[model samples]
Structures are given as structure tokens and as C-alpha cells.
Target: MTKSLDAHYRAVVVGGGQAGLSASHYLQKLGIDHVVFEKNTVAHKWKNERWDAFCLVTPNWQCQLPDHAYDGTDPNGFMVKEEILAYVDRFVKKVNAPVFEGTSVTSLEKVGNLFRIQSSAGSVTADSVILATSLYSQPFVPRAGERLPEGITQIHTADYRNPAQLPEGAVIVVGSGQSGCQIAEDLHLAGRKVHMVTGNAPRCARFYRGRDVVDWLADVGQYDITIGHDGMAKKKHDTNHYLTGRDGGRDIDLRKFALEGMALYGRMTGVSNGKMLFQPDLKSNLDGADRVYNGINALIDRHIAEKGIDAPEGSPYVPLWEPEAETTELDLAAEGITSVIWATGFTPDWSYVGLPIFDGTGYPVQHRGVTGVEGVYVLGLPWLWTWGSGRFLSVGKDAHHVVDHLAAHLDRTRRPLKQMANG
Candidate 1:
């Protein structure tokens, strides 16, 4: 039997990651009686989901939490997974956030004028609710994975720890995003044979013109640009380019992988009778990546010229690998490939919320975190307001905006009651 406890607050924030923590910071400043309910410990995903060698693609200075910023000596350095977790932990302590660790919100529904949140520990009612669970909630693997042989081992990027975790054999890493390329590099460096399925994602160097690409983007106001502005919405939905913050920061070009003896193929189409089928568009994929790469460099060059910034002329990026005619299908047994790593990506899951604010695709339909449902808001969704809205550098801004709207909503709704009581 489940026991119900009496609890109430002016606002309830679900999830205890950066988004939730940021929201809590603003709520504290606003003097809103609120509590953050986390499914596990604070920043659980950063602590567990990431691999041992994983580092943030963005630099340390970009880790701007609400009321807290990265003040470390290595501002340009990338933060390792543990470092990120520690930073979040420090922020939680600094703000003295009212977070209930280990508590999971099983369901949320609207009850009369209040939002009723049922959790494993108990229940809480709040005038407003902020769903800051973030976009990366569930690991997404393709349906073709089910067709692989029983002997083969499969792991998603979320569960992958290191090369040693996989079986000793040639490993096929599906998806050529940042995770896929980085994992392939790790496995190759560990002396394991690696085969990667390359996609059409772009690639960019860590630094250009004596400055990190992140710094250039930030200087040019790229991060501040919102989605739905021009063609940004389409760009936001595109697969991220191949890049890594490991070993300092570097580009994860397909050509580089090919030169390193990693067998590269086009996108994984399907699996049939223990054979993995791939499209023979390696050249096209490489070309697409090069286009985006050159485009970014061009933008940087233009920025330098227009601003008259004192920067050296960066060398033009050149592709090194030429495609050789390769077979489209690989016999798993014949090739000695024993494992598959799916670095595909993640999807958002909001089934726990019983609100009608979600779209047909299950994403919460909101305008800058303000849901159509009264007093219900969402945060940390990709492109919620801007390209960087969901990222750590900018989530604080989104949280502040949402909290301001929430406060206004409460004031408008509750002011009448206070006036009547005074009368």
C-alpha cells in the first residue's frame, strides 16, 4: 500500500539536473516555496550515463549555471564527466536548493486549480510545475538492432563505459555522431579493431585562427540565436557534427578515422541474416561533412575581416581520405565482429505527465517553456528558445524567463484572493 503525505508548495520542479537546479536558483530568488524532485541523486545522468573518458564538447567557461559560473583556472579546457558532476553538486550546495534526492515523480496531473505530483516517497501539490527533465531522457536504438545474431553484444552510448567493457573482437559502432567517433577512437587506441558507420554530420576543428570554435561562435552571438529564426529550427534538428573534447579538443573527421585504419562505411541500413547492410555513399557523406566544415571556417574568416580582429590566417581544411570501392554488406561472422555499439542518440519521454500539452510526437508543446496548460511549464528542451537554450551555458536564461512568467501567473491568479481577504 502507498502512503500519501500532505505537502504543498507554490512551485514544483521535476528533475534535478542543470535545468532543474537552475530553475530552483531562480525560484529561491523569487521567494517561491518550491521543491525539486529528482529520480536519483542530483545530476544522476552526468554521474552514471556518461562513459569514463567522456568530456564536455563545450569548454569550461561555457558551463554557466544560474548564480554560478565556471571560475576554474582552465577556462578553455573541457570538463571531464566527473568534473561536470562535481560542478553541479557544488551549485546545489551553494544555492542550498530544496531538492529531494532519490524521489521519482511517477505521475503528474492537474487537480482543480493545483498541479498534483505523485512520487515514490509521497505526493505534493503545487500552484505551478516546471518539467525540467531535459531532452535526453531515453536511449534510441534503431529497429535493425533486433536482427543481429544472439551471440553478438549490443550496447547503447549511454551504457558504454570503455573499450574493455566490449568483447574482444572487431567492433561495429553504429552512427557517426560525436559519441560514435569518440568511442571508435577509444576502441582503436585500445588496440581493438573498429568499424564505424559514417553519417552526413559535419566536422569542425577544436580551434581555428588561434581561438576555439566555441569562442568564435560565442563572440559572433551564435549561441544566443534562437530556433525558428531563419532556418535554425532545421539546423537544430540535424545530427550533430563529429567532434571530441577528449585529449584536449580535436576534430573527429571520417577521413582521419579512415587513415587510422578504422573501416568506415556509409549509414547502417539494416541487418539481414547476420549481415549488416550499409549504403555505398561514403564519398557523398564525406563531401557533405567537408561542406559544413568549410562553411564554418568561412564564417570565421568573414568575422575576422569585418571586425579587424588580430588573428592569424588559419590553414584551409583539406580532406585526406579518398573513397575506395567497398562492399555494402559485411558478414558479421566472417569479419569477426562480435559487438555493436549504438551511438545513435536519445529521445525525450514525457509519458508520466498526464497533461494535454504534449504534441503528437510526445514533445511538450510550449512557447519558451510556458505550456498551454495554466501554471505548467517545461525547460531544457532542445531549441526551447534558442540553439543554446538546452545547453548548460544558456539553460539559466531559459529558467529565469520561465520563472518570471510563472510568478506573473501566480500573482494574477492569487491577487484577487488576497484583496478579498484584506477587504
Candidate 2:
């Protein structure tokens, strides 16, 4: 028989990164007796991420948890990994969020309305569990990746950190997403011949009103906008652009790397012997990206025109917007790209939760994160509600909203005082 563990709180939070920490912070404010279970140290993934010269795409001014700022000299600047880690550490201390570090929640199952969670440290019965782990839990290398010839070495972008870590031979980055592009650029700069496998070319803003695109988003309520599935799909289809470039006093573009002859390919299908190959439709993907960019520009113009908005006499004219199509698949072995980094995107996996309450997509079936499975909630999902809920720097606010909703639910549905005392 399993030993009965204490159930002192209504909720238990999983993970110790920004999402979990932020949830714990709000639970404290609401006087909820809660604890965070972290499989590793604070911001563990960030520490383990292969983020060489990586900086937050979101601006620093918007990157603070409630009741705490980064507390550094450059509060308005985007922070690197070190700065972010330090900030999270400080936030934990400041809020006094109850956390159990090194404690990993191994499994979770819904027993009636309550969730029985098993952890490496101990078992806990919580009325609810907040899964704050990021969607990037699983690095998705393509299926064909497994069949590569034994002679070549393969490393996902998740495993890539710096230029020196890569093999001396020519490198090919598989995905055209942010991670793939960044890694490709880094490898190329390190004096290694690099090939960027084209999946799809994304539209990137030239300048958002004479400032960084991130800055413009913040200014134009993009961060505040809550978009649902339709909105998110529209955004993705409409804006194929990925955020790139270092901050250049508010406006920096990374056209230099592209202009420097980064060898571009169509796409990778498979590998044979030791030779890597690529498809021939590489130009089509590039063209699709261009069309997307033009579409976004056109949309901006339409929005301005529809509003009959008057800009300053010297202001740049905004273009009308439209969305471009996706790209076709390509052959890999023919192009001789031995190494491939899968940067397609990320998805949330709640298999460990082991709860039947999850949707087909592994997301909790809820109205704004409150599932029928009592005492369970979720936060920090992309576009949680059409209003730009899960942006790079939007976790804190999302956590707060989730915590509030959970707190109210717990208060209204908590077991009676006498029943609690007997337990």
C-alpha cells in the first residue's frame, strides 16, 4: 500500500523556470500554501540550452516578473543567459516563493477531482497541478534523421552551443527557423563553410517605425493583444518573419550575414553513404519568404488606409499586408549536408502528467486553462488567448492570470475546514 502523504496546499506547481517561479510568486501573494517542484535548478533549461551569444528577442523593459525587475544597469536592454539567470534567482528570493529544488515530479494522475503526484523526493496530493514546463521539452529532429549514414555526426540545435563545438568539416543547418539561422550564422562566422537548409523563408521587418521590431510590437500593443487559435494562425500565416539581429541602439538588422554568402539549400530529404544532398526548390522557399514579407508590408498599409490615419509628413509609408504560402520538401543527401539542426518549432508534451484530462494536442482542455479536472490549471501557452499571451517575455503576466484564476477556484471549492483538519 502507498503511504499517505500530506496535502497541505490546494495546488502544486511543476518546473522551476520562469513560468513555475512566476506561478509560485502569485500563489504566495494570494496566501495559498503552495510549493514548486523543480526537476533541476532555477531556469534549468536556460542553463543547459546551447545558446551561444543568445539574447532575449523581447526587450528588457518588459522582461520582469511581478514585484521584481532584472535589477541591473541595463534594465531596458535585452539580457543574455547569465543576466536572466541572475534575475530569476533574485526574483525567487524576493518573493519568497515556496519551492522544492531538485525535486522532480515523476508522474501525475487524476484521482477523482484531486491529482496524486509522485515525485522523486516524496508523494504529494494536490487539488491542482500547474504544468509550467516549456513546450520545448522535446527537440524534434526529423524522422529521416535516424537513417543518416554512420560516418557522419549529427547534432540538433539544442546540442549546439558555440562555433568551436562544431566539427571542422562544413556544417549544414537543417531548419530555417530562428535556432537554425542563428547556428548557421555562427558557424559561418567561425570560418567554417556553412550551408543553411531552406525549409521556408520567414518575413522579417526591416524596421518597426525606425526602431527594432520588438520595440514596435510593444509600442503597438502587440504584447498586450490576446489572440486565440484563429488569431495565432493568422499571425503565423501572415507574418512568416522571425525576430533577428542584435540591438543597434533600438534598430538593428542582420542583413550582413545573409549578404556574406551563407550557402543556402532547398531542403533535406535523406542522407546516403557519407554524402549529404538537398532538393532543387530552394529558390521557391526564398521566394515564398519574400512574398510573405511583401504581404505583411501590404497589410500594414491596408490597416493605415482603412483607419484613414495621417502620419507625420516625413514618416515612412506603411504597406498593405498579405500572407505567402509554405515551402515544398527537398532532398537532403544530394546536397552533401552531413549535419542537420531541427528548428522546426516546439510543442508541449504532458505525457508525464498521465492525466486523461488533456486534449488531443496534450494541452489541457479548459476555458482559459481551467480544466474540468479539479485543482489543475495551465499557464504560459502560446497565444493563450489571442491577446499575445505567450510572447517571449509574457510569462510573468500569464502566470499571474493563471494563479488568480486558480486561487479563486480553490477558495470556492476547497474542502471544508473540519475535513481538512481530520486529514
Candidate 3:
């Protein structure tokens, strides 16, 4: 039997990830009556979806939530997946957030002046709704994956737990993003032959001169730079830097991977005659990555020189190009590659929300989290307000902004009701 209950709230948040929790904190601070509906436990993605070896790419100092920032001794260190989950748990307890665990929202529709939210636990009517589900709700594997051989196993990065979960044979890791490079490294280190489809993803050295590259970027306000300005949308959609937080923070350059015995190929185009087809653009991809890598180092160097700060001189990161094995096609069966892991990235799932606020690309049509429709907002989306909006370092800031907008909206909506009651 479907259990049903009726409830009302001033605002309702749809997810319980970092974005949702951050929004809850601000909403509470603003004295707003709200509830967070999470399909699973708090920080569910960190607890359930990520691999065991997963560690935050950003340093601990960047793990700032609403009122809880990292105050530990290892501010420079990275927190593993378990540590991230526990940190969120502690934050939820500290804030005493009104989060309903295991309550999945099935449908969200605007009914007259109120937003009707149907969840597993019950239905909620709210004056405002904040979709904090972040951008990674759905794993995206290209349609070409469906045509792989029946005997080979295929898995997306979201479903990948560890190398042991895979069958014992060579593995082809598609996409040269952070996840793809890291997984390929894991498989290679686990004694499994690994093949990777390299792309034009940027690479950053873990450390440049005297500090982490992330710190340098932060100091220069690189992350604070807003996207969609001067043709940055294409760069924003590019695959993330080929970097890893594993092995105590290090760069995972694809060229190095190639030198280390991992078969490297260009981007996978399609499957033809039971063989995976790839473009002969490996050198171009390597050059693109090198451009970004050297660009950052140059920025750091310029910063040091301009600020008159004493820093050790560092050489520019040169591309490690290999001339051998420049093939554009691979026979899956002939190479003994038994598994294909797609780390192509993710897309947001908002099918349940029957709102016309989304653009043609399925992304929310909003300006800094405020949708065109009144009382509907989205948080933790890339370029919501800035490049860092979706990151942990800036999610709280975005949440606070969204909450302020929501509060003002409520004040406007409730003023007439109060005036009518008083009259």
C-alpha cells in the first residue's frame, strides 16, 4: 500500500548532497521552515557511489561547508570517500538539519501558487523549491557502448567500485577525464593490462613551485572567474584535468601512462566490425593537454614574479610524447580486452520535475540559481554564479545566495496574506 501524508513547508530541497545540506543550513539560518528530501542517506553519493579509493581532488582546506570548515592538522591533505561521508554526517548533526532520509521525490509540479512535491514518504506543498541535486545524477555512456561484444563486460565509472570487481583480462578505459585516468592507473597497478582512450583533457601538476597548484589557482581567483564570459562555455564543458588525489596527490598525465605501458589511443569514434575505431589525433590531444598544463605553470610563474615573492624556479611541464603504438583501431577480442569502463561523465536527471524552466540541453534555465519561474531555483550547477558554484569551496556561498532569494520571494508572497488577515 502507498503511504500518504499531507504536509506543508515554506521551502523544500530535493537532494541531500553537499549542495542540499548547505542550502538547509542557510535556510535554517534565515529562519525559514524547510525540509530536505533525500533518496538515501546524507552525502549518499560519497557514501555509496564513489569508489573506495576515491579522495577529494581539492585539498582539505577547500572542504568548507556552511559553518563547518576543515580545522584539522592536515589542511593540505585530501579526504578519502569515507572521511568525506563522515564529515557530512557530522555537519548534518551539528546543524540539526531537518533531512528526511530515504525519502525519494517522485514528482514535482507547480500547482497554482504552491509547488507540489510527491515523495516516497508523503506529499509536500511549498512556496519555494530548491533543486540541489547537483549535476552528476545520471551516468552518461555514449550509444556506441551498446554495440560492444556480448562477452565483454561494460561499466560506467559511477558503477565501478574497484579493480577486483572487474573480470581478469585487459581493460579499455574510455575518456581521459580524471575518473578515466585514475581508473586506468588503478587497473594497470593491479596487474591488469589497461588501454585508455585519451582526449584533450587538461593536466595540472600536483605542485608547481612551493605550493599546490590548487592553492595557486585560489590565490589568483581562477576558480572565482565566472564562465559563459568571452567564450568559456566550451572550456567549462571540457573534460576535467587528468589529475588524481590518490598516492598523496600527484599528476596523472596520459603521456606518462603511455610510457608506463598502458596502451594509449585517441578518442573512440565508433565500433566497426567488432573493432573499436579511434581517431589518429593522439598527438593533438597531448598537445592540447600540454597547453593547459604549461599555461597554469606560466601563470604561477608570472604571479611569483609580479608579486616579488621568493619562489623556487620550476621548469615548464613538457609533454611526454611516445612515437610507438599510434594505431586508430583496436580489436577487442584480439587484444584480450575483456572490459570497457566508460568515464565519459554525467548528466543531471530532472525528468521528475515537470517545470518548463529547463533549457533545450536539459540544464536549468536560471541566472545565478533563480529560475524564470518564481519560487523555483537550482543550486550546485556549474556556472550557476561562478565557476566554483558546484564545488564544495563555493557551494555554501551559492546556497546562501539562493536562500536569500527564496527568503525575499517568501516575504513578497506572504505580505498580501498578512495584509488581508490584518484588514
Candidate 4:
């Protein structure tokens, strides 16, 4: 719903995703006057950017929005796409946020003491700004995809719906991140021939010991660990371990797929003539993924033993299949490959904000959600505060921290003015 836009506000939130809405909830709780500008409808990414079988990798219990947690019966289960949409919709209605849907903030700059925002809906001024855009807003397909035969139907996973959507033939799925692995499994399960280019992204067991790995990790306080932990800051940039929550949660084991006739390849190089090329790193990629998988399980084992928890025993993962021949090249036509799915993921684009707050990598320089520059705050970034900071579970916590700081800062500044006026 479009609301009446005013000339000025105490705070202005850019981007109306979970992060933005969470911040809006807190600001409203504190009686702060603000407007949330959403370029698209709320949860637009979830609505459009996902494949058909999309479900939460984390359990439904982790759907911790501000003032709302998952109240469904399937707390341990993952919420499917439809349920996820409904959840976000409920939050939008609950907040009754002061938002301008379809309003895009084209540019934002600090004008004197106020932040001036130019949006599709027009300009507005604010005392402070919350840049609440998601971590990855733009889908990235490599230029190498262009080198492929124009005959092959090419798509990024964001556009992928199901196996029925692709032409009937073998499909080459690139990248081994969450989407890549899951889509490959989806196609494979649908009896479509799948050839995957497995990247060095890690994998994890969906269930370890007697409970889901997520439950165990949460018990170990993993989600609460901040980004400042040793060797943890860099984890923000790491690829999430490949797993799936479809038809109940399960590990996405590429080796198991390979054993079941799914051809596995290494990183994609380029296409020449009709042949798809790859580096001869298939064996190493598989092993590296397994190491992370086993390592995580081992951590859980230690925690269980130390606490003497009576959980079912588990064993380390032994490779189900190994690649003896690393095929660095493949004749696409001979292999009957008719389509390519690039699950290469996304990159952040924040060119509109006329601020020197971003790092060389385009990440905003911020402590928690508060940016280095005064009056500028960023939210919903992965590892912004913790491992789950960008996730549904922890986004609310981060929002509270930032809004608390914002409120306190405003109050402290206001006290001086009141004192000066009275004096």
C-alpha cells in the first residue's frame, strides 16, 4: 500500500526487505518518525528469485523476525517457498510499516546535517538513514557463459523454476553452492541427466547424531558467536555448505549423486566450438568439501562427549565415489547437453549511495550494523555481526543493536540542545 510521503522524517530506511522492516519495527516501537522505501514489494527476492523447490536451509524455528517467531507446528522442519512468503507477508502487515512500495532510492548523500534521499517517489530528508538492502541484490552470470554455444539455453539459478522448464536433454549445472547443489539434485531426482561442475564450496550433513546439525550448532552457541572470533571474520565471504531442506532436510552429497550416474566435473573454464571446458580439479573439490563436512560432525561429537549427552553415535563420511578421470573437456553436443545453469551466485551493487563507507570489495565499513560514517547505518549483511546476522534468526538481534545505538545517539545529542535552549 502506498502511504502519504512527507517532506522530511526523523529516520529514512532504504530497502524494504527483512532487515529494513525489522529496523522499522524497532523505530516505530520507539515512536520514531520514519519512512521505508522499497524499490520492489516486500520479500520480492523470495517471490521471484528462487527455484520452485525452495525451502529454508535453516529450520522454521529460526524464523525470528522482530516481535514474531515461528509459531507453526513444524518448528524443526524447513518452511517451503509458499510458507516463507506467508511468513514475510504476515510480518509486513504486523509492522504496518510506513513504506512506499515500488519506490526506489536512486541516490543518498549527507546534505549538511540531514541526509537527502532521492527516490523514484521523489526526494525526502532525514536526520539518519538505514541502508537495509540485502547482501546480494544482483545475480551474476560469468562472461564465460557468453562463450558457450548460443544453441544452449543458458540461465542463472535465479531464473530456474524446474526441470520441465528446460529443454529435454542433459543439463550442465555449474557451481556447488547451496542453489547449485540443490538444483542439480532437483533435476537429477526428476530423471534428467545432470552434469555438475563442483566448485570448492563446502558441504554439511543435514542431520548429525540424533538431531539436525543446526540444532546441535545452536546448542553450542555457534550462531551467537560474533564476526570478531579468530578465523571467523573471513567466514562471512565463505560459500555456505551445500545442503537441502526439500522433502524434509537432507545433505546434498555430490559424490552420492555421481554414484547414481550424475557426471561430475570441476570448475568451468570456457566453451570452445561445442565442447565445455573445465579445470582438472574435480577430485580435490570433492575431497575438500568432505573435509568440511567431517570437520563439522567432529565438532558436534566433541561437544556431545564433553557434555555426556546420550545422543546416537555417528561415523565420519567416507567418500561414496571418487573421480579417477578428471575430464577437463567435454563435447557438449555429444554429451546431449542442451542447457546450462550458472549458480555462480550474486554480487552487491550500491553505486547510488554517494558515500565513502564501502570497502574495496563493495562491503560497507560498519561495526555491527552501524557504519563508520555518522548517521549512516547498514543492515542485512552476512557476517555483519554474527554468522547468522544476515539470516532470519539473527537479523532481528542486529537490528535491535543498531536501532538502540541510533536512538541513544539521538537522545544524547538532543539533551545538549535542550540544555543550550534552557541556558
Whole-structure CA lDDT of model 4: 0.89
lDDT of 3 by residue, 194-297 (tens): 99898877888888898899999888878877665777664435567778778679987777777788888898999977899999988888888888889999
Best TM-score among the predictions, by candidate number:
4
Full-model lDDT for every candidate: 0.85, 0.63, 0.84, 0.89
Ranking by lDDT: 4, 1, 3, 2
**Could you give candidate 1's per-residue lDDT for residues 121-146 as a string of tens digits?**
78889999999998788899999999
Candidate 2 structure quality by residue, lDDT tens digits, 1-423: 113335655888887777787788777666677778877777777778757677665557766576675556765567776776677667767766577777778899877767788888788788778988766667777767677665456777777788777555666677776667666666776777676776765755645433445554454455665554443544422323555444422211123344565566676766555445567666676666656655655555554466665642223333223113223333334545455556655555676778666655465665555667666777666555543445436677777767777866776787432211110
Off by over 4 Å in 4: 415-423
Candidate 4: count the clashes: 0
lDDT of 4 by residue, 134-187 (tens): 777888999888888878999999999999999999999999999999999999
Clashing pairs in 3: none
Which portions of model 1 miss their true places by more than 4 Å?
A: 1-5, 415-423
The parts of candidate 2 lying over 4 Å away from their true place are: 1-8, 70-76, 229-240, 245-259, 275-280, 298-339, 344-347, 386-388, 415-423
Report how far off residue 354 is in candidate 2 (Å).
Answer: 3.0
Poorest stretch of ten by lDDT in candidate 2: 414-423
For each candidate in turn, give its C-alpha RMSD to the true structure in angstroms: 3.9, 5.9, 4.0, 3.5
Taking all chains together, each candidate's TM-score versus the true structure is: 0.93, 0.81, 0.93, 0.96
